[model samples]
Target: MSTTHQPTPATARPVGPPTKHQLAVMIWVAVFPTLTVLNLALGDWLGTLTPVVRTFVLATIAVPIVIYGLMPQLHKLRVRLLSRA
Candidate 1:
């Protein structure tokens, strides 16, 4: 009896880390929705603050949600998408 090992298909290989451009695109995609929701939910309250304060508040709120919440899901989605293609 002989045993032969076949190489895995490309699609079966583990996906690599995202490139800088991919990361940038993911960030942009994450930010657009985050901003939209934040604006709708807090536009009136945030409007009360000065521009700098408003930006700071938005960044504070949006960054974590994007980095921790949205980004991982997006990365998974990206991996699924690339694997299909």
Candidate 2:
């Protein structure tokens, strides 16, 4: 049996780390819509809490959503976009 190893294609290779600006843009894209929707949906309930408590709640909720949920999707999008370029 013969084994042949072909070079990896561009699409097969993993993308490098994002630049600072790219990371910032990705984070902003993920965070803005998330915070906006969360605020709109929870505004009435959150408004009843003190300012600090409301902020704390929002951050707690937003952090998980941004980190675990939206960020992964955003990273995938970034990779796809870069690959297409």
Candidate 3:
């Protein structure tokens, strides 16, 4: 007697990791905020010279905001990937 096995089609495959573009976006989304906070801390510690420079420096807070917004989504993605393995 012989046994045979078959695999499902591509469309049947489970959705997994974020695509390359999504991964890139995710990384940028995560990193931007962290970098922003870093920039702000540096600016404050070093004391930027002008109002325009300060405004730009303050904009670094957006890094945490962006990251906070994405945390849930990233967490969800992480859980899905881990469970699959």
Highest lDDT: give the candidate number.
1
Q: How would you encode candidate 3's per-residue C-alpha lDDT over 1-85 as one tens digit per residue?
A: 7575443455344556667887787778776776666666776664745767655655555545556766567858765665555
If ranked by TM-score, best first, what sequence of candidates would result?
Answer: 2, 1, 3
- Please provide, for model 1 over 1-85, each residue's C-alpha lDDT reduced to its tens digit, 9 standing for 90 to 100: 7786543584377789999999999999999999999999999999999999999999999999999999999999999887765
Q: What is the TM-score of candidate 3?
A: 0.39
Worst 10 residues of 2 by lDDT: 4-13
**Clashing pairs in model 2?**
none
In TM-score terms, candidate 1 sits at 0.82
Winner on lDDT (1 vs 2): 1
- Tell me the deviation in Å of residue 45 in model 1: 0.8
Task: Select the stronger candidate by lDDT from 1 and 3.
Answer: 1
- How much is the lDDT of residue 47 in candidate 2? 91
What does the lDDT come to for candidate 1? 0.92
Candidate 1 displacement at residue 79 in angstroms: 1.0
List per-candidate RMSD values in Å: 5.1, 5.6, 9.1
Q: Evaluate all candidate structures by whole-model CA lDDT and list the values in order.
A: 0.92, 0.90, 0.64
Q: Tell me which residue pairs clash in candidate 1.
A: none
